[model samples]
Target: MRPQQVIDGDFTYWLGDMYALLGEKETALRWLRRTDEISNHNYPWFERDKNWNNLRSDSEYQRILADFQRHWERYREEFGDG
Candidate 1:
């Protein structure tokens, strides 16, 4: 099932979050990577999202988040939202 209103590429992020909530770290990360490739979201809420708390200690997750943070920061600087 899916929500009635969703922006492009959020489906992948939802899949990743679902997997993370289920304790499927690897699968979650895989979907997240795909989301990153597909949407490259600004990620204003990503770092603080509790959905990925399970991955907080994972190195790969950290790396991905770091990359997202860099990109998101740039996005904010360019767009003036943040």
Candidate 2:
């Protein structure tokens, strides 16, 4: 059976984490990006998240981090720091 849809912030975060662990950096980033868009509570997790450990040294990962930082800054300005 297909997995049930996840409609919560934490579930999206964990799904991103799972994808990262599975070595799917692009997919993981996509899900994590969605979590960022949907939930302010998930912002702090990215800095020290273990799921992204493997990607730490990758150039693509650095780009993703830069993009995330930009998005986060914009989010803070628009939403008033959550």
Best by TM-score: 1
Question: When superposed on Cα atoms, how far off is each prediction in RMSD?
Answer: 4.4, 4.0
Question: Which pairs clash inside model 1?
Answer: none
RMSD to native, candidate 2:
4.0
Tens digits of per-residue lDDT, candidate 2, 1-82, equal 1123455768777887898999998777677666655643444567688778987887866665666677777778999955
Worst window of 10 by summed lDDT in candidate 1? 1-10
Deviation from native of the Cα of residue 59 in model 1, angstroms: 0.6
Error of 2 at 71 (Å): 8.2
* Model 1 TM-score (2 dp): 0.81
The whole-model lDDT of each prediction reads: 0.78, 0.70
TM per candidate: 0.81, 0.58
Runs in model 2 deviating more than 4 A are 1-6, 58-82
User: Model 1, range 36-70, lDDT digits (tens) per residue?
Assistant: 77665647677888999989999999888887888
